[model samples]
Target: MPTKTKAKSLPDGQLDHHAINEFKDVPIRATIEENKKIMEELFKDSSDIVLREFDIENGPKAMLCYVDGMVTTSAVDDALKALMILEGNAFSIDRITEQTLPVTQASKIQFYKELLTNLLSGDSVLFVDEQDTAVCLGLRGGIRRSVSEPETETVVRGPREGFNEHLRTNTSLLRSKIKSPRLKLKSFVIGTETNTNVVLAYMAGIVNPKLLEEAEKRISRIHIDGVLESGYIEEFIQDQGYSPFPQVQTTERPDTVAAGLLEGRIAIMVDGTPFALLAPFGFWQWLQASEDYYERFMATTLLRWLRLGSLFVALLAPAIYIAVSTFHPEMIPTNLLLSIAASREAIPFPAVVEALIMELSFEALREAGVRLPKIVGQAVSILGALVVGQAAVQAGIVSAAMVIVVSMTGIASFTLPRYNAAIAIRMLRFPIMILASIFGLLGIIIGVMVVVGHLAKLTTFGIPYLAPVTPVDMSDMKDVMVRAPWWKMKKRPKYMGTSNVRRQRPEPEQ
Candidate 1:
């Protein structure tokens, strides 16, 4: 059972505590008044809790306990109407649930822990005057956002539907994609106070047993007070703590989660959050887009290469500028060198300092835009960059050449499909920029080497981070470097260690 440790002081200066041990093993009392008093004590400060006391016709007394606005009022009324007009005097909880109440999803609860769980989960519980057991009705209701296109991962030639905050809705979306009995969604209740519902989704036969076991072990080890989002689970279950690169991929699209499951990856979904976590993520996947599988292989391959190029530009553009202008000016062509020199003539700051100022400003503006309303954000980010860059150049605070470099870098970062991957690159850019300032091009080279080495050493759930590329698995490269045509790509990733390697049988001769 879950635990709650917080203590609230009563009006008489006594500590009113609901510790786990106090009620974790406590069973319901036979008297309705006793049960009602215990429940009232547990929910003292809560005003939304409703304890509607009513009498059954020719039968014993009963009380309905539920949170207002959380349960269906019509259903609760119908249940009361049915119970109040009962024909017999029998008043057992089992008899009322099985033969009397009109509620279809009613179940008997014996302990307070189960009672509290069902009550908080938008269900209505009933307490009879002489019964120890209570009936719990599934009447979950309240306002929830409808499904819509994901804000972070918008695609043109794919399913427009995205996962909503509702856990059942998200699971249904995945079920719609991969309609197979083998697709299993095992549930777990985590967090002591929140009791957040988490599901581990995977293709039963395709996922390796060891990988699944490890994933479960890691997740089950998380002992926390509450979990509000899937990111909380992601942080706890990831293999490496300090790695900037995300070991588990987060996506708001159900199709993406389904795709990962088909490839022998496990997806972790948390309640009250739309984002799902995909484990055993690879380096190349950072550049991969969901649209890749929907379009022609050739076009998708070209787009992948474009994103790869942008990744380099975002990572190296500013550092290259800093290195060349500060130390390798001779490497520049005569005309371009003269133009750059003239642009920086009145600028007081060096190339490195100028680049830092522009980059930091751009980052600040991007963050501000994201935090603000959508309509206003776009305008602020776009106009802020243009106005600030031009003003800095005109005021001789930074060179025009530096502005172009910073703008290019910012644009390149935007091209990355994954937000977390883009953030990692953006963060690394500063260190590389500082290195270039101190040791010129050699420092940039050293920084790049260190990054590459760290990535090579990283792993996601025992699978190498740079799979297929670093380990040189040729069969898996079809989807890495270039997404091979669907028919031609006949096998799942070998690195996943799945027994079912064949995604499709070979095509017959033309």
Candidate 2:
């Protein structure tokens, strides 16, 4: 897709709008020299591209062109050996492809651009002297990252295997969990220069037709220079493109994706990225984890409440502390207020400034921990927080009460299952803290109103971002605010509009 970046646009500023070039329209020449001329011109100064010309026994002159490290050398050697030993009197593309190739996958490519796409994707192309088409051998093999347990979405009692960067492997992982024949995996080529492979996985009958169409339409509308990862695809297809809250759910765990698909959601998987994007997702889904489904329902139910509480604390702890300590001292208990006032006796900054200073410093230390080496990052975050909080308090820059509030808030944030959700709450803290300083508890109320309004207004592909709660679905309350027992969860999410609504049969007698 070298033409991706250079693709000429129409007068209205649309991509791929130019007339087809004569080069792509040109058929492979009967003579080997003419074809070789075009090939050499296309790959002018490339050193890694290998082009081998040889005589085929009882066949026309032939050439094999492919990238160096993409294909196995021994496979190519064996293919040559097999081609040369054949005693056929005539060259036929079908016969050659069906009989001679030692590999499993092969196809006849007709156009120049198609051949280029295949060769670039790590397949070897065999060009016969007088044939107008080329044989594409599936020889893609090289070093790839091995599949292992995902570091971020780890679970104690579920499948430990996580998705790797390979597209086929990820799809296979989904299929293994969902053994139904209706599971569909469709491919789309995105990014002009990278030509990355993106797959859309969904169940045919279970997925909503309108939702699937919308997702596919959004993906087709993206004509970027390159798509290096699934994040690239995620941004392109998300509903609220500018919203801080994630409209798309990202997960590296295979079980998570499989669960989403079973509930009638479509997944987008990009090559060279372990993370996959799930569509038509809601905010509550982020609070749910893989372990929630695997663990006992009672335990998961309790954990959900803890996560919900943590989310509020992460977002409002600092703001509330500032309001209560500064302008609403009567709201606090007398003893706590005295303790907070004593701690702030020598501090020179106002409540808002004090909170912001500590919050920003803690956030910086956290970022340093993440950006540093893993072993060093853990030590830096832990020790940096301890040292900075203690030193700031002793130096009389911040109160001990403020330090405790910030620490508790940080702990609450880490309790979130999804990093993206936690990040949204984390980033929103500063604005609310400023609001708290300006108007005390009233400012906090205004900020909460604004956030709730935005959340209610937001939608992910026509499904409410704050689904079940905002739409006020009475039946969905079982799973949204709390985890219902396995047998109690008798139907799929109402928004899915799936044909088969019953998720399971009635529970049998004990």
Instruction: Please give the lDDT score at residue 399 for candidate 1.
Output: 92
**Model 2 residue 249 distance off true place after TM-score fit, in angstroms:** 0.3
Top candidate, metric TM-score: 1
In angstroms, the error of model 1 at 155 is: 0.8
Candidate 1 lDDT over residue span 1-510, tens digit each: 876555443467443555433445677878887777777777889999999999988778889999998888888888989889877666666678788888778899887878887788789998888888888988887778999999899998998999888898999999999999999999988887888889999899999999999999998899888899998998999889999998989999988998999999999999999899998987899989888899999999998999999999999999999999999999999999999999999999988899999999989999999999998999998889888778888999999899899889988998988899999999999999999999999999999999999999999999999998989988888999798998888889999998699999777899
The residue pairs found clashing in candidate 2 are: none
Off by over 4 Å in 1: 1-22, 87-92, 506-510
Candidate 2 lDDT over residue span 1-510, tens digit each: 354333332356333322123235546666677678667756779998888999888877899998998888899998898888786656567877998779899899887767877888889999888788888999888778888999889888899999999888898888889899989999998876778889999888888888889988999999887899888888888878889999888899889999998898999999889999998778898779999998988899899999999999999999999998889999989998888889899999998898989999999998998899998999999898888789999999999999999999999999899988889999899999999998999999999999999999999988998988888888878887689988788999887676667788767899
What number of backbone clashes does candidate 2 have, counting pairs of residues 3 or more apart or in separate chains?
Answer: 0
lDDT of 2: 0.86
Off by over 4 Å in 2: 1-24, 87-91, 506-510
What TM-score do all the candidates reach, one by one? 0.95, 0.93
